[model samples]
Target: MTGAPPDVSIHHLRAITNESTVELPDRVVEILAAVGPDTDVLVSDVSARSFAAATRRSYSKQEPNLVPFINSLQALGDELVLICQVEHGDELVTAVVRATDRSLVAATAIDRSVGIVHITVQELCARLRASNAPGVELALEVASQCLADDRVRIFEQGALSTARTVLTKYTMAAEKGFDVRGLDGFAGALVPLGDEQPGFCIVQADTSVGITAFTPGNADVVAAMGIGGLSLHSETTEETG
Candidate 1:
């Protein structure tokens, strides 16, 4: 039993120019600003149970169809889908687009290549604001079925699964430090807090010690640990901030 399926809501959003004749909603503008450009974006609302199950499966060798699961949200309510490629690092921010009160939603980056993301929402808006292009009014049922079929080809290939696994490890490393490293199915590096940071010590996979992040100019912090120490942060928030 992986877990329960998450209750998902699907929203369809399209890019509209700032100078477009149509009036845009504040929610749409804010999301566009946070996400920026480049990379495709998929919006969905899923039950915490389903999301947890998917997250568990993500750690497994088998791959799960994320977009298909997202598409399934269409039938629950109005379907609003925005397809944009979010850049690997910077443009990968996620948010929740509601019917009228759109707000930021915490998202865990799954497969960045295809922009597969997870969000929990109870319902979605009936329509989007300030759209001058076609494809914004996709039928809920049609989009769901089409996405289900398309996800099959990708799942069979297994690339998405592999990517998700590596990315998940990377996220864990950055957040929880290298202590989470060396666990089964985890493969990644200990990145320093900054380009020229000195407090962080990079350790190799074969070594027993784990790598971690830290603020620059904190050699004393590293010295106190005596070589195998993995410092995730320093006393000051200067670099961490």
Candidate 2:
């Protein structure tokens, strides 16, 4: 799929939940009615027990901005579901994201639902770091495959958080054609060189794992930073004596 454009615009719709039953709000129903037959939409419930559904059209080889949709829904309540669809590259892509204890659960444009797919931060990072594929494409693949299989588990609480830091650094480095401070907060800050070429440098790849911080600017950067991988703290941290 082609990358997202700079200055991307996203359409948002929200529905309120009823206290008696789990029915959608009028606004949500209205938005769904407005969606065209050709357009796909994503529906998600981000309550404590999160759930999500994506329309079939979302799988097409195009990009859609669902960040606003997710963030808006997140603000409304700890528990709510919203559906949204956007057109990019003339193709319809529907998606949903749910916040869970360890990480945010999201849906893919493909038939696979993002909520059901279980990809940990470590596996995603290792795979992206190893592959030559664009960040977005690879993220879809990794998330999809993980969902299809039951035996694989690579993430913990800190994975996605860590991935974001790496992604920010990678994008900043590429954006300036040089390093940026705080990009690698965990690692010591790389010395910032304004004009002169530094002798030592951290390697920056052309593509990045797709994640929110790197989005909204350009599809290339989105593709480059597709869903940045997670950084998982060891499962077995010791308690202080």
- Each candidate's TM vs. the true structure? 0.20, 0.21
**Which stretches of model 1 miss by more than 4 angstroms?**
1-39, 60-100, 110-241
Model number with the top TM-score = 2
lDDT of 2 by residue, 1-241 (tens): 1121122123322221111233333443443445555443222222422221121122222224444433444454545322223333222233333323212223222212232223344444444455443333434434443323333321111122223335444566447553222233321111111111111101112322233112111111112223222233312110000
Choose the strongest candidate by lDDT: 2
Candidate 2 similarity to native, TM-score? 0.21
The TM-score that candidate 1 achieves is 0.20
Query: Model 2, poorest ten-residue lDDT window?
Result: 193-202
Global local distance difference test of model 1: 0.27
